[model samples]
Target: MITVRPSGQRGYADHGWLRAKHSFSFADYYDPAEMGWGALRVINEDRVAPGTGFGRHGHRDMEIVTYILSGALEHQDSLGNGGVIRRGEVQRMTAGKGILHSEFNPSADEEVHLLQIWIEPAVHGTPASYEQQALPVDAMRGRWRLVASPDGADGSATIGQDARLSATVLSPGEALGYALAAGRLGYVHVVRGHLALNGIALAAGDGAKIGEETELHFAADDEAEILLFDLPPTH
Candidate 1:
């Protein structure tokens, strides 16, 4: 079964420095029926204004992944990890026990657009760690590129969960397909542009939840970027 969630139906918040759309409840946005999908907890698409960004914050027992869409974000963490994440880069932070981090837009004129994802870890109270990798454009041009997995398979950043995250960029007329194992759950998030999942159309910011579906197809109606997650059954 596939259920669609329209772009405009998501919760929206506009703070002068940050404009974010929450696919699942986060911060002050709350929706009882939209809590999450399987182990996928939060998908926050954020646009941070130039010269401003998120201050130091703490998280625990969560697998946090940051996907950069444009500009750059300077990250500093309590674990002594610091770096600048640019477009095409994926950052994974395992807030096992607890961790403090801050993301800032270092650009003076360009706003940074990114997606912050939070997943429930399969294990808890482990040591915190971080990993960052730049994904090659060719790898995702017309196919799903694994970005995060439990074991870091195919060079993807490792996560503390039994889930896989993949990203793709499709041009008009391009199509892709994926198959899920029995008893697995699937999720599709349209990062930008328009596309059709199976036969239903989805625009930027739209999302879909899948259950009992073994095969999934994506056809691009316009240039589009997307993120897909294969998750274990909810606990």
Candidate 2:
């Protein structure tokens, strides 16, 4: 079964400096039916104005991953990790025990566009950690690039959950296929342009939940970027 979450149907918040759309309950936005999918808890598409960002916040027992869609995002955490993640980089932070962090748009004039994702950890109360990896544009062009996985398979970033996350940037008419093992579920989020997932059209900011399906297909209608997750039934 496949359920589509329409772009215009998501919870929206415009805080002047920060405009965000949440696929799941976040901050002050709450929707019981849209709470989350499987082990994937949050998928927030955020656009931060220049010189503005999220202040230091606390998190625990969550495996957070950041994927910059455009521009850049400056990230700093209490674990002493700090850096800028650009369009081709993926950042993962495991707030096992606890951690405080902040994200900002450092540019003087360009807005920062990114996706902040949270997945439940395999085991709680571990130490906090951080890792970032560069995903060159050439490698992701027209194909799925494994960005996060439980075992860091295929050089992807490691996560504390039994999940695998992959992303891709596809040109018009390009396509990718994903096969799911029995009992495995999938979720897809479109970042830009458009796509047809098994004949279901999806535009930017749209999300889909998949279940009891053995295979899925993604074909880009235009230049499109998307994130795919393989997750357990629950966090």
Candidate 3:
């Protein structure tokens, strides 16, 4: 079964300095029916104005991942981990027990556009951790590049759960296929351009949930960037 969630239907919050859209319930934008898909708790698309960003914030028992779509995001955490995540980079922070962090735009004039994701940890109170990796464009240009995984397979950043996240960049007429594990599920998020999942078309910011399907396919009408989540269904 495949269910679609259009971009326009997502929750929105525009605070002048921070414009965010929630794919699932988050920070005052609650929707009981759209709580989450599998262990994926949050997918927040955020645009931070130049010279501004999120101040010190706390999180616990969540595996947080940040993907920069454009511009750059400067991050500083209690663990003394500090760095600038530019386009083509993925950063993962495990807030086991608890952690305090801050994210801001590094530019004084260019806006910072990025996606913040939260996935439930398989085990609680493990320990706080952080990981960052640069994903070259050529790596995902025509295939699904594993960016995060439970076993850290394919040189992917390790996450705190039994899930795998893959990203792909495709040109017009390009396609990719994935054979689903018997009981695993898949979630596809279109990040750029237009694409067709199975047969239904999806544009940027759109998401699709697939469960119990034996196979999955994606095709792009033009240049497209997509993120795929392979996860064990959550109860």
- Candidate 2 local lDDT, 34-67, one digit each (tens): 8889888999989999999989999999999998
The residue pairs found clashing in candidate 2 are none
Candidate 3 backbone clash number: 0
Q: Write the per-residue lDDT of candidate 1 for residues 5-63, one digit (tens) a residue.
A: 88898999999999999999888999999999999999999999999998999999999
How high is the CA lDDT of each candidate model?
A: 0.94, 0.91, 0.92
| TM-scores for candidates 1 onward, in order | 0.98, 0.96, 0.98
Candidate 1 RMSD to the real structure: 0.8
lDDT for model 2: 0.91
Which is the better candidate, 1 or 2, if ranked by TM-score? Answer: 1
Top candidate, metric lDDT:
1
**Candidate 1, which segments miss by more than 4 Å at Cα?**
none
